[model samples]
Target: MSCQHAPSSDGNPTEADSLVIKVVETSAAGKQLSELTKFTASGADVVEITIKPNETYQTITGFGGSFTEASAYLLNQLSPDNRQRILEAYFGDAGARYSLTRTHINS
Candidate 1:
């Protein structure tokens, strides 16, 4: 489902908020719970895995990749249609939904 783009108090369209992604299905276990699955190796090896959700651990900030001037220039040189496609492919709900992008300061 698409999110509505609401105007902020400053009267500017909230583009970021409009990009909210509704998750229909996910691999994550239930809230505050974990899922266990078994694995079998080549022949004689067998293993059981436990994902403990109750355990408090370091929370993940997000996933992302680096951005460079070369990458930016490539994107900028693309046609508008192609540029939009690339943007959606990386940032759209159907895409990777990356939220934390990092870039190097040095060339």
Candidate 2:
């Protein structure tokens, strides 16, 4: 089914409330959340959705990178073993290299 939009129950019900969503898909065949580009759905099977856009209660805002001191502080707050595990996870070959510096740290 193809959905265009739906009426927002929080607001009033109307054609405008119908949520016209941009459809995308991810597949093992290399479709990484790609839009359903040229496909169109019609007939009674066409679906609709509604959402209240302004209802978000909270959000996280930050830059993409560079919170170095913050990282050091949180890490130091952990116990010795916990901190070591965290450090290993960040710097180990099989883990994410979240370490900005090549040098190792001791706490």
Candidate 3:
């Protein structure tokens, strides 16, 4: 697979702060397995993955926080199919939470 660095909004090539993989030769299943293993082993302690269609950049927002936690939060808010896909890709698990904490207060 060939990897290319993404450009910033200003059209300048940005320094890569994270590893980006471009799948070329691998089978879809193999690619998924490899990607999952690599991300899991990155020693990031916490990872946030934003899954979206290649045509759009509007999906989950990575707070640059924990992937597990962020994913859980997303599951609570997203459709079942989307939640399941993300869970399977990241944690290899699928379970939804009904209760979530909100920081807002009534004035």
Cα lDDT, all candidates: 0.62, 0.62, 0.47
TM-score of each: 0.54, 0.30, 0.22
Clashing pairs in 2: 2-47, 3-47, 5-18, 5-19, 6-17, 6-18, 6-19
Q: What tens-digit string does per-residue lDDT give for candidate 1 at 1-107? A: 22234456765544343333232433455533232333223375633333355787898988878789899889999999999998888888999888877777873
Number of colliding residue pairs in model 1: 0
Off by over 4 Å in 1: 1-44
> Candidate 3 regions off by >4 Å?
1-65, 68-71, 93-107
Candidate 3 residue-wise lDDT, 1-107, digit = tens: 44444555765444443446544444655554243322222565754444333567566532222335554566789888987676555444343322233332331
Tens-digit per-residue lDDT, 10-102, candidate 2: 656765543444668889999887878544345886755435577787774521234366677898899999998977776766667554653
Candidate 1 vs 3: which has more TM-score: 1
Pick the winner on TM-score between candidates 2 and 3. 2
